[model samples]
Target: MTKVLVLYYSSYGHIERLAHAVADGVRQSGASAVIKQVPELVPETVARKAGYKLNQNADVATVAELPDYDAIVIGTPTRFGNMAAQMKNFLDQCGGLWFEDRLVGKVGSVFTSTGSQHGGQESTLLSTHTVLLHLGMVVVGLPYSFKGQLRMDAITGGSPYGASTLADDGNGGDRQPSDNELEGARFQGRHVAQVAAALASANIGATL
Candidate 1:
């Protein structure tokens, strides 16, 4: 079976909600989706004081398991125009996998949440893509086929880069991902999973 990993780091649950939506899309395409979170780097007392979503249901993911999935959908809240340090740290530990080229040819996708409409959403997605490319993965983004990104009537977060959402006021704000944003995430998930299933079923790299 085609397997996908929806890996994310959410300080206050905004990206967590989007991650589940992405997983739902993966399941829509008959692929198994496992959602996991990166380890929190903040001290436990500081995290609690900041009201981080410490009780997130997803387990912390390990670098060793990332290669097991046919596709990986990454999510993060933009931090100064890039992925959060927690997620970046997690990926940084995958040098062993990169050295082995273990993730070569796997599908990779990314999503993000920002505190404002212009708060580095695209940059975050693009920068993350750089890592995926370095790992020799085939990258996928939320293409125009997902029309939710085209809606202009509301203040929403989404782009050709990937599925995204605005995180309300700031890191700890209460605003959740809007319906259009979630739909876009689901669309991205389905697209990535479909592509991975096709590649896996064909066993296309057998030439090696």
Candidate 2:
């Protein structure tokens, strides 16, 4: 079975929720999905003082294990229109894999959450895609086929770049992903899995 990894760095639970939706979408394609998180860089003492969600139970992703997957979908909260430092830190550790060309031909995709409607969701996704390209990975993205992407009547977060969510609730509520955002994540996951499976099959064919 094609193995896809849904890796993310979620300070709160917003990205975590979206990561689960993406994993669910990958499973819908009969692929094996592993959902994990980037290691926290913040000091434990400081994290507790700031009330960061340190209790997240997801397994931590290691650079050595990245080459084991056929596809990788990464999620992160936007930090100044880019991925959070924690996620970037994790990817920075994978230079060994890039040097070995271990991730070449693997499928890669990105998802992100922003604090507001125009909070650089697309920019975050694009930035992540740049790293994937540098690793020689095949990048996948959400197509216009996902009808949820075209919803302008109601506020939603999704674009051709990838799945996204608005972390801020309009009514001064806590940060969380909306239902539409989760659906967008699922669509991205399913699409990436499908593409990865095809690529895996093609690779096997070439070897035969």
Candidate 3:
């Protein structure tokens, strides 16, 4: 079966929900979805006040193992209009994969959650795509053809860049994704899965 990796980092519960929606879409498209979460960075306040550990395991898979997936979908919370440091740190270790072209021709997509509407969702998505391009992966985005586009709120989630969710950060509760945002994420997953499956089949044909 075609396998799609849904890797993400979530501090709160919002981005996690979006990851699940994306995985559901991939599964609906008849591909296997593997969800993995990056290790979190314990804040200094938490370490001092809550007695939390500052650093933890760093033994996550290296980029050489990325080829195990037919496609990859990544999710992150927008951090100053860019991917979080942990995710970037992980991607930076993919230099070997870039040099070997292991990710070439594989499908890739990005999703993000933000504290509010207009809170740099597009920027985060674009930043994530930069690493994918360097790895020679085929980038995918949501098309307006999907029915989810019509129902999204003007102020909340769903974008042509990729799937997005507007999360409430206690300043307001109204910015969270609507049902349409959830559906849009699912659509993106299925779209990438279909594209990856087609490419994998073509590769098989060439080998045969």
Candidate 4:
């Protein structure tokens, strides 16, 4: 079976929820989905005091296991228009993988959340894409066919870059990812997995 990894970091549960949604979408496409998270950098007491969601269910992911997946869907909360330090730190550990070209020809995608509607959501996703590209992975994104990203009916988060969600501008972390945003994530997951499955089945790398 084709395997995809939903790798993410969440401070207040927003990205965590989206990770699960993405995983569900992956499964719908008949690919195996595994959800994991980067380790928290904050000290336990500090994290608790900062109101971080300390009870996330996903296990901490190691950099070594990333190459096992045929596709990887990364999620993170934007920090000043970029991926959070925790996620960056985790990705930084993959220098060995990059040097070995271990992730080349694999599928890669990204999703993100921000504190406000215009808060660097696309910036986060796109910058992350650069990393995936450097790793020689085929990048996939949430295309317009999802429809939810095009919706102006309500305050939402999503784009051609990837699925996204908006936070409450740090107003106590009240704004959660909406159904539409979750659907966008699901769509992204399914889209990426389908592409990865096709690539895996094609075994195009074997001829190269």
Candidate 5:
């Protein structure tokens, strides 16, 4: 079976919810979904005080294991229009994978959450794509085929780049992903899984 890794860093609960939704979509496409998380970089005291959802239950993804996935979908909250430091730190550890070209040809995609509607959602996704491209991965993104991407009548986070969510601008953390946002996330996940499966089958046929 094609394997997909849904990896993310969620300081709060919003992106965590998005990650699971994306995983659900991956399963719908008949891919095996392995949901994992990057290790938190925050101090224990700060994490406890801020109530970070450490997600102790999810497996910690190591850079060496990245090559095992046919597809990888990553997520993070926006930090100055870029990925959070923790996610970036995790990716930084993949230098060995990059040197070996282990991630080449894998389907890579990203998602993000922001504190405000116009927050760095798209920018964050784009920035992550840059890293994926550098790793020689075949980057995938949400397309217009998902009607949710076209719905302007409602407030949501989604673009041709990747899935996103607005998590309350005032740092309230009260806002959650809207239905449209969740739909967009699922669509991206399913699309990536389907594409990865096709590529994997093609490679197998080539070998045969």
Candidate 6:
């Protein structure tokens, strides 16, 4: 069976919710979804510097284990118009995979959550895709043809670039994803999985 990796870093659990939705979509497309969370960072000092936190349970796998998946879906919380440092650090460690071309031709997609509607979701998604491109992965995006694009009244997650979410405030009353946002994420996941499967099949045909 084809496997798609749903890797993400969530500080407030919003992005994690999106990852789950994406996984659901992948499973609906007949692909196995492997969910992985990046390890948090630990600060050297008690002052809590720029990017540091403790990750209690981190995955202990190398890039060599990454290529086993047919596709990758990454999620992150937007940090100052970019992905969180923890996610970027994890991707940076995949240099070995980049060198070996392990990710070449594999389909890749990105998802993000932001504190506000204008909070750099697109930039965060594009930033993650930059690394995927360097690794020669085929990038995937949500198509305008998806019905959610037309029917949603207040869409906080649908983007032509990838999936996204506008997180709720500190009051704990605004974190829930709207129906449109959820539908968009599901569509994004299904679209990426279908594309990855088709590409894998095409590559197999070419090999024959």
Model 4 scores a C-alpha lDDT of 0.93
Q: Tell me the number of clashing residue pairs for each predicted model.
A: 0, 0, 0, 0, 0, 1
- Measured over all alpha carbons after superposition, the RMSD of each candidate to the real structure, in angstroms, is 1.7, 1.9, 4.0, 1.4, 2.2, 3.6
Candidate 5 regions off by >4 Å? 169-173, 204-208
Residue 119's lDDT in candidate 2: 88
lDDT (tens digit, per residue) of candidate 4 on 93-186: 8999999988999999999998888889999999999999998899999999999888878999999999999889456548889999999999
Question: Tens digit of lDDT per residue, candidate 3, span 1-208?
Answer: 9999988776655777788889999999999998776766666676457543333322344455688998989888899999988788788888888886778888889999888778899999998999888888889998887766666345557778898988784576535466888888999999999988998888941232
The C-alpha local distance difference test score for the whole of candidate 5 amounts to: 0.90
**Clashing residue pairs in candidate 5, if any?**
none
Model 1: lDDT to the true structure: 0.93
Model 2 residue pairs with clashes: none
Instruction: Name the 10 consecutive residues with the lowest summed lDDT in model 1.
Output: 199-208
TM-score of 2: 0.95
Give a tens-digit lDDT track for model 2, residues 131-181.
Answer: 999998888998889999999888889999999988788665676777877
Q: What TM-score number comes out for model 6? A: 0.85
Q: Please give the CA lDDT of all the candidate structures.
A: 0.93, 0.90, 0.80, 0.93, 0.90, 0.78
Sequence-dependent TM-score of model 3: 0.85
Q: Under the 3 Å rule for N, CA and C atoms, how many clashes does model 4 have? A: 0
* Least accurate 10 contiguous residues by lDDT in model 3: 51-60
Window of ten residues with lowest summed lDDT in model 6: 51-60
- CA displacement after TM-score superposition, residue 109 of candidate 6 (Å): 0.4
